[model samples]
Target chain A: MTAAIVALGVVVGLLGVLVVGLLRSHADVLRALHDLGICEDDLAAAGTAEGRRTAGRRTTRTTGEIRMVPGVAAPGASSSLGRLVDVSGVDPHGGAVHIGLEGSRGLTLLAFLSSGCGSCLDFWRAFATDEVEQVPGRDTRVVVVTRGPEEESPSEVAALASDRVTTVMSSAAWDDYDVPVSPYFLLVDGSRGVVGEGAGGSWAQVVDLLRKAAADAGLALDDDRPRFTRRDLLVGRDRELRADRELAAAGIEPGSPELYAPLHAAPGDGADGEDGAR
Target chain B: MTDVSSYGITARLPRGWDARIAKRPDPAGDPAGPSTRAAPEEGISTRSAPAEGDPPGPLAGTEHPVAHLANFPLPPVRGDYGSGAVELMRADDIFVALVEFEPEAASTPLFSHRGIPRFGVNDFSPHTMQRTIAGMCGAQAFFNRNGRAFCLYVVLGSHALRAPLVAQVNALLAGLEIDPL
Candidate 1:
């Protein structure tokens, strides 16, 4: 009973602060809350009114810098040996045993990713479920390149490698390969000397190419585009959704509403800015 | 775009012909100017100070890429030494443009400026290289360097930005201009 009374006093104290602070600060707490899509009642309930106002202002400021990804300038040149491959932690698949590109498999699907990249995760999960033997025109072998080492758990590596997602931790993916954001895929054709690269966002695109190439090489597998549903957006198979979540900190900003909506929906904010901030 | 094959002077254009002109900040004073409304955290209201015609300091003269190029020395690659002020006729807006001729291609290039990326630098493909400039402002200013001199393309932008963009670009590039290649 005492605990309940203390909680009520605390709530009343918070309410007093939020209301008094707004009147004194002249802060536009209402618009900020609306922009964040936070319900009014929830703000009222976040303890003191000051708490809600602070929360609202903080959220709005964060949303300001996120704009869409600029379009690609050119189809970059196809990477050659030094142009694509970097040995020793360059393309790690979690904790999977390192196999040199010179191994029986001379090819590596250089998938560049970040710890918080959404598109990279989408591609990773999709490729796992799909078969590799029957792709019509692409090769079947694969390797992963990622930025953050601390975020890569051994279990995550083991899970992806079970389906052959060999991970390589390499800064060269960004420094040498020109991967600015996460999920940039490079399909290395070492023997023929051609590294076809496109759409780093989706692993399915990579898998589809691999399947097709394998089929052309007399290896056949049933691989198709993995159509993602709304449910998949919430708890995706891959954890790179962290990038999408992190973007809320840098996405929408307070500006002319009409001009900003379009930018909020661009890449880096995650699939058309699905984070509700867009 | 005219028949100026023997032209000796540098030319420029504005940006308004193509881009959407953004409305300047509200008339209640300079929108970009400091707001009378103090941020809630600081609460430092300076409205009571002097009613000067414009905000104070060196900010008055420091404007556009042309101004920056004035003090800057000739880049490793340049056709001439001079700066210009190019505004987009369509936008009538204030902005700065930084242009460089192709590195591999002749320092003096040529073309009509159009599109986002504008032109491919390495490929030197005509108008095929257009991409938006990230972190700066609108439009990428790539020059087709396949083999042509760079200014030949500056002549092209002279017609495209419609007016302001090229004028501003050339004004900055003007300081570095020499006799045309």
Candidate 2:
């Protein structure tokens, strides 16, 4: 009987705290509305379920646009794989490895990555799952070149160690080739010559580079365009929807809806002054 | 023979003059002279010749290539020199250099005298090339072309060659062609 009485007292105390908290939250909202000079009637309307739902819809309607800058079109990128084979590093199983034109045979895709880089983590998933060998017309191999001791690599990088994907722990190759930035790529031919080199700012750009290299080698690519994953699309959509709702709630109008859309160059459209920042 | 086609500027050579593009070597490897951004260790010292049997550093026994009219190794080679700036012309006591920098993302006072937003080196200072500028005048100018910033630096040691070379430099600037952004 005493135990039952204690349980009842605990439940009653929890209910009282919750009720007081709700009342305080309502009072705070009303105070904010008063500070904003909202009339009592308008405040009452905002408190209604219909008014709140309409406000939410309006918030979603005010969304910002994000446009991707077009990547550099591949030049007449022919193969000139380097004949000098500079040894990059030992593999995970303690085997020697060569990258780019330095390798003995096949096309070597050199990926300059760092464990601390956020972008590398983002695109690494796509890169790992992409059916690189099925690209037709070339025997492609991927090698990741990074810095520091192999054992000290982050979990994301350490997970990429395998027979298919060789990881190196040195920047010597990068310095030798004068790679300007991280996540850069160098495509090499069977004869150890450079086919093409470019910045891998996005997974799409990297895929496009490889496809272009394959195409330049006179091989047809089988719909080689990089496609976003289902998760990527869903997450992106959710973020946009949230942004629209939040923007509406904050009373910020979406600036230039067309900027959020894909850019289609119209006839005689002068320079957009967008390149100035890039 | 001063038609330097690189960096989109064409410079015509005056009679009895010739020119070729060359990358500037690093002082650590080739201490031939100091550059505009030369470091403290790259002192304003006289060009030194190495004693016999001395191992080669970059400038150990080699005379200044421009002064002696010899070939200087091109850059993009590790531990040699910067890959950007190149010696466009070296004839008599005059040296013309050209450098190209990637475009700036936003126009933030990249150059002086022009309010126009552009990209490039705004803080360039002239460095004395001891071998070439023993007794001469040097000047550098900046401009934007083809969505890249270009630096045209001229060093003239002989007073006799300055006027003619200035005219050639002007001609090079006049014939410049930059693709629209």
Candidate 3:
């Protein structure tokens, strides 16, 4: 009777786990597959098409980790990325809001632009026409960082914006972002973080990264505070101790807990150094 | 610098042309792997990979840079260069073609850069050499360098062999009248 009971419980548990896993992240899984370019209709063709390496070139026969290209190495970008720069070069109206906020965060910048770039003309015209929002910490009634070449006359700036656009004439601190091209705004998140190879012509992609930059600035607002969480290993110990209680209850003979107390660990976290197996 | 002495043609072939030539055993013995999937009825090793006793692929063109060397022998029928066997992909009227060049297999391009030319001997006809080379056993024409060099390419699957192979084949033009580039 006891064996029959245990068998029934195991079956029920497995079925429940399967159903829950399927319900969660099914949409993300589908998106990941689509991004990976896997499709049911062209599965066979796709396999052969992308399956081979560059045409005529011999397939590289080396084992793992030996790289072909040199110098351009990825130092280490493990966690979330850093600050992004959004260069806005449009303004409408006179001096009141025109000349302001160029050198705020010790950041150097250079923006090569004129009203000539079609995409820039469109975005600037929109901001000048609409009320823009101010980025936090900076003393500004309206938003948007609009600075450009010294050659650009006030009339050209006016031509790009409307009464609503809040303009700022900042210094072209060139060394700050390592300005590669025109209308390029490079943002260094801090001394340690830098953003490169960003969207140059595509405004939509730039705007998305711009929003990410704002979010990144907000993260920096924690400023001087020493913030610690489970990743710091301090509070995490309490959580680990609590996890022990649950495992203890789940083990054989709870209070006494089978001669050896069950130790909890991740693949590499074990003190016994079995981590090398991974 | 492989021991080419095993191939009967080695002594007759020049020492300078060695790097461009790799002798491999005929894959006719292995009934599996890629060569097995080739034109098995023809008895030639069809897989693009070279087998023992095979020659290199087609030469790029008539004006192949090394065409001047009179003594350079094309890859011999049966020799081993440590990179498997030589593969011969083409033999045509445009050029007498034999492909051999091992890029990564052997330590250097041509071990010691030493070579020999066996075909340049008095009796062999360089002008009508296409028919003589096409008769090589295993595989027929394979391209060593596509059209890049004065090289010829016999199609494999849908693509052609690349440059490194062509350079080797060009080096094989020993005893030809053309001036060295």
Candidate 4:
């Protein structure tokens, strides 16, 4: 009986050691997956991450305490500000096309999507149905950018394109924008450059992310600034021309008394009832 | 510069310019055609007397290819001659349209020009504008290229500034290529 008891104790010790080893191995696997941008939720949902990179440069996540916002994911570490230069690439029809982003008036949303990415299907379908308009509003133009013909099939991109959206297959644009993954977005204000960028699981999340980004950038979507009409420009020009003609007819050239007389008038003595003199 | 080609028409757009090449939708809603939607109007509507009658639909005839290039943002929906987009132009803005006709029209008098016509400052006129918007000028050229009949219509935001603007238009046209239909 004493021998049997000692043997049982040895067996239990071995089992404990095996259990500890298994736990450590599982933890290491999880850590590696995390490094590859796969989270526990992703694993639980799909069993395997779609478009999982087997071997390549990994995108570095931002360090420090990240305050996660509900619905909107934080931007990747590669995000930056500045004008997005012209995007040159081949269209779905195999013709080369260049899209000028500089000096434009409104926002241009560059959607980095891939035909092979399962997550990107959601965006493609949304764009086809015009649901993307709800996110950026009518003022923003959406341009879908995919990898070049070498990395992607132009026919597949064409099949996924919507007549309403302008799609460009440009691998250079991906490199220029530092796109780390598929289904990423960069919101560029024509005058202000890149104001927001990030990834979202769905269009709803993207809307929230862009809204937060624009707000943080101090851009109001409701833009109430007055726009000058063509008539206004013409009227202003005509008034200036007429004033010049009248002045010339009266022989009132530059530095004439008539022009300076209004300025030198005493306060509250001007025709317009405003102070002309200090 | 970027080369955009579709339906046998091609253009090389310069920096700060946007372009599109597409075919008008079949009015009969052919499943094989590009689209089934009606063609958009080419200019702002100014209601004439009812006796003058409403203008004919822009795409009332057979379907053909159309291309648009603009120095400013090109809206997804616009007329062949830029009705919807012209309203958004600034003083320095420009819109160019290249509309193709049936191959048989290549010999017609309107399309008598053998090749693309060069644009000059005199080509643009304020009275030639589609909608008569102040400060805007327009020019049109009908030509035949490689058995295809084509019309090149250009709109400038400022008629007084057509010298430099027409030069830009001519430079853009210089890079245009039309493949056999």
In the range A1-278, model 3's lDDT, one tens digit per residue, is 99999999999999999988887778677677566544444334435655443322212211112232221222122312343332222222221111112212222122233455564554454344422332222212223334444645555554453334334333342223333333543433322344322323433444454556645554432235433354656658645643453233223234664456566645644332222111
Q: Which candidate do you rate higher for lDDT, 1 or 2?
A: 2
Lowest summed lDDT window (length 10), candidate 1 chain A: A90-99
Give the better candidate number (2 or 4) by lDDT.
4
| Candidate 3 TM-score to native | 0.25
Worst 10 residues of 4 chain B by lDDT: B46-55
| lDDT, candidate 1, at A143 | 56
Compute DockQ for each candidate against the true complex: 0.01, 0.02, 0.00, 0.11
Candidate 3 lDDT over residue span B76-139, tens digit each: 1111211111233322101122333332322332222223222211112212222233332222
**What's the lDDT for all of these models?**
0.34, 0.43, 0.30, 0.70
Q: TM-score, each model?
A: 0.26, 0.28, 0.25, 0.61
Question: To one decimal, what is the Cα RMSD in angstroms of model 3 from the true structure?
Answer: 32.8
List candidate 1 segments past 4 Å from native. A1-86, A90-99, A102-106, A131-139, A148-163, A192-194, A207-278, B1-181
lDDT of 3 at B32: 20
Candidate of highest DockQ: 4
Q: Pick by lDDT: which candidate is best? A: 4
A88-145 in candidate 2: lDDT tens per residue? 4433322223332422234567777766666676455655564444323334556677
User: What fraction of the true interface does each of the listed models get right, in terms of native contacts kept?
Assistant: 0.00, 0.02, 0.00, 0.21
Q: Give lDDT tens digits, candidate 1, residues A69-140.
A: 443222334333235333333212121112223211234566665545455556556545544322233333
By DockQ rank, best first, the candidates go 4, 2, 1, 3
